[model samples]
Target chain A: MNNETEIRKWLEDVMDPEIPVLSLVDLGVVGDIELKEGSVFVEIRPTFVGCPATTQMKYDIESLLHAKGFDDVHVDISYKSPWNSDMITDKGREALRKFGFAPPPKGNLIDDIDVLEHVECPQCGGTNTELQNPFGPTLCRSIHYCHDCKEAFQQFKPMN
Target chain B: MNKTALKELLFKIADDQLILGHRNSEWTGLGPILEEDIAFSSMAQDKIGHSYAMYQILEELGEGDPDQVAFFRKAEEFHNSQLVELPIGEYSFSLIRHFLYDHSDFLRFDMLRNSSYELLAQVSSKIRSELKYHTMHARTWVKKLGTATDDSISRLQNDLDALMPYALGLFEKSPYEEEIISENIFGGEEELRSRWLELIAPIISKTELVLPDPEGVEPVMGGRIGKHTEYLQPLIDEMTEVMRIDPDAEW
Candidate 1:
């Protein structure tokens, strides 16, 4: 298979350990995958600087590619353009919703609005929620308390 | 405090962070689970960031460039205690190491927040906020592992027995320790050490684990004076390889 095709297939099996439903490529954290000469290069942007999954993600990628006969694999971390919920592909969002996380509201496009207008609860489908903390499970997400469900859930926010 | 003393103090703080950060980064791809993978990596990054910040302060004080001060320093010049440089043996060992260090770090930063040096105090304040999460994360894992299956509890206990003595090394006094205290650069080291033990005792007790006696345990010093474990050289080589390749090149 060609490099692009090979990378796309490799990434399909690379699932997010936390959410399980989304792959790194689907999450848009996998910025670019290229074949230079005989080597494979993967570029990723971390959800946040200190996100612990980053280390594991690098290791998993290397092993997976190695298993596929790619001896030279380079992983580059880019922090120039910070990550945001908007980067989540439509397919990823769908997968997340099916996996029980209330995906970003269907009508609220990330680019159309400057700030998150209303974050719908992942549980109980309620719009009535308040931010519980700026930090959630990780720095990339914010904890929001759903008044309807009375449960705290993480909402992926745009990093500024 | 004299300039020499201030520089030593900076080295102590920076060396602790550098070594600890290196240890944490080793867990990047090997975490037991993904959620935890993210958590541990973040802590490592915060530590490295803190180290860089400390190095920057030293640079301004005419020590050297941040990278030079961090990467080129001799092993004997480093002031970090032995606690941070220890290997991250098993998962339990790693957890115990973090548990002891994170709590002590939190208290240290809190005290440093009131330092006579305004810049130092401000930096401490910023680092303290991030350290709160680090402490929470470490505490959660300690509780989870401690209360889990019997095997897990035993593993944690064994790890604690092996590493607690090293944790005491964090309080080993440097020549500048008294100078900083007298000048109010920061609070007294003995008082801080006592407070650290007091804060950690209940946490350790809650885990049903006995605090290992640290009496007469000679600290494995020289990290703060730049004598690092064999692990550090290889780590620094890889971490700075790219930067070193083109020192004059801008990214």
Candidate 2:
């Protein structure tokens, strides 16, 4: 139970409430796991400063550990490590695509916001998509239209 | 480490975000287009989130509960600039206001990244990144509409000219400005205003929109000192209506 790798493996089952297909670990928000004395402590980073799902994610983490017979569990929402799209694992990006959302282009957005206009279509894998709105239904998502697929979709926005 | 000075600064910044966020949220389901509906709503969430963080920081400093401070405060108690409290009169006016407001907001937070107040600095750094998207959104629309047609350009220009004095009020000096700067808690409003002007000029220049000459504009002041226009109190009252039903009710 004290195995950090094993604990992270278990965390892969904790899916984001908004995007049920992706796990919190793969989402790159789960920060650290530590077994101190008889308790397990975890740190989770926030993708957006005001992301409402963060609270639900915390609850899900705690519930997952408690069901595993861990009597004492502590989960802290931290800003220390900071979550970025670059941290989203390759497995996570595939999950986003499967979920019909464009994965953010892999780069620090601090250097280029213009990349929003060029997202690949999750459905058709086309680069002719147009960014309809940089803001979306959620804080971390951007609305885009894929001319190839003739459909509107969302992207997990690139952030550094 | 002047707590009074720090709280004063935090209150004003937080108030600005909360007030503007409320205004932004008013566009939910009412935007001219679906994309605009989503943009305003999303930005509203980010701004309110930023204000909530500021309130939390204030709470950690031994103030009232964040909600209490946010919902219960009178209009006079709020330190947000007069610019934010004005009604979202028209889409053009709203767009013009957003352009002017977000530039200053972005620069203020960017400068706050170097604050001697570690927590504020950390929060500022995080908030600044999110604000980049907002500023980007504003700049894109302004440039697009500002040069689109004579009709569009005229509407945006009039609004921009009308809003200039009020926008300048965003940098109204706090009484604690001396201590705030001396303690390195912030780069003062004067410095921020200069930087904001420098940053916004290029964006405005790219568009056909005409920026008002600052020297002739009499800067609207007094919002930072709790004096406000008739527009503000009604806004505070409307926002607090639900919370007033049961102020102590636990969510």
Candidate 3:
């Protein structure tokens, strides 16, 4: 029953349904984990309120914990605070770039002169890239094209 | 007292988001610029996600599964406004529609944040934050393109004029509008329309685009009661293409 570190280790493998390269831990969506009286309670904050993946993520977490023999598991969907792209760990950013999607800039888009002007191409590492679209295939992504590689890629959008 | 009325209200709002999200998604890979392609896709996903959230609320009140409710419904069964169902035509038309629809869309969410229905209120509070980005994106484009070059301004203005009637369809009142209002599930449509006008007018004024005379234009109605244009069914068919192929398949 004293498998707290093992539980955390198990949770680390739970990937974000949308961006599969990043885990819930890497995305910073997993908040507090508490165990009491043989019951485990975990809090997860969604990337967006309407994210469909949030529902699946909850189910995945619960099932994973259940498979681990933690029968009394409670997954609380927390809306007390919103998730920001900035919460994405440096490792998560590298994973995103490695997946061929440009990771969102570290800080807010408001700090930049132009939101599109500065993104480095994930494919060719080119700063001389053009913004193809400020919006992309998903709510958290935008499309960019690199002049060097001439490849069209998606960038995880910078969230405010 | 009338649960049906509340369901109708929810259905229309959900349907509008779903249909428009589909339309916005069509811009993926086809946008004039790649950034816009992604932008439309992002908003499309957000809108569809919002619709799915609303559908889940409906399921709590005894509707079918969200996937079936969204993907299996016929065009005639849909309650989305005509504005949303229309093809995402030129970039100007889509942009103008986004500008027009999202402004009212946020206002509706703002009103629903205080809904007497606990679920709707909870959903609204969560959704409103996401929608702020939508409105910001819409407004920024409307302002940027609306004032840019002579060609851009003229194109945007033409779109504004053309889409006015359809845009007004957004406020077509529910048959249970009074019931919903009486129960505090929503503020009335007239109230939302007025607030929408007040909010959008100044922003539109800032652009070279002129606001169409609201008094003279006739709002296209019927979407609130499930009547849609010829376009909706085909769009629905396209959206459900994969679902129809294998309803049991994991999307």
The CA lDDT at B177 in model 2 is 93
Query: How good is the docking of model 1, as DockQ?
Result: 0.05
Instruction: Give the lDDT of residue B180 in candidate 3.
Output: 89
The interface RMSD for candidate 1 is: 8.8
Name the regions of candidate 3 deviating beyond 4 angstroms: A1-28, A31-43, A50-56, A71-138, A141-160, B249-251
In the range A1-160, model 3's lDDT, one tens digit per residue, is 5666667778989999988888998887887788898898888877776576888899999999998888999998764454777888888888998999888787656334376665899988988887765555656666677788888888887764
Cα lDDT tens digits, model 1, B1-251, are 46777777778888889878888878888978755666667677778877877887788788888877787655556677777777778878888999999998889888988888777786676566557667766776788778788898898889887777667767766677778888888786687778988987877778756777656555555555556667666666766778788887864
Candidate 1: stretches off by over 4 Å: A1-160, B216-218
* Native-referenced TM-scores of chain A, all candidate models: 0.81, 0.96, 0.89
Error of 1 at A99 (Å): 20
Please give the distance, in angstroms, between residue A121's alpha carbon in candidate 2 and its true position after superposition: 0.8
lDDT of 1 by residue, A29-91 (tens): 887789988798888766554466787888888889898888999987653343555678899
- Model 3 chain A lDDT-worst window of ten: A109-118
Candidate 3 residue-wise lDDT, B1-251, digit = tens:
57898899899999999999999989988989866776787888889888987898899789999988998988888989999999988999999999999989989998998888877887676677577667877888998998899999999999998899999989999888889899998998999999999999999999898999999999999987788899999999998897788788865
lDDT (CA) per prediction: 0.73, 0.90, 0.84
Mind giving the per-residue lDDT tens digits that candidate 2 earns over A23-113? 9999999998998887999999888888999899999999999998899999987766667789899999999999999888887655576
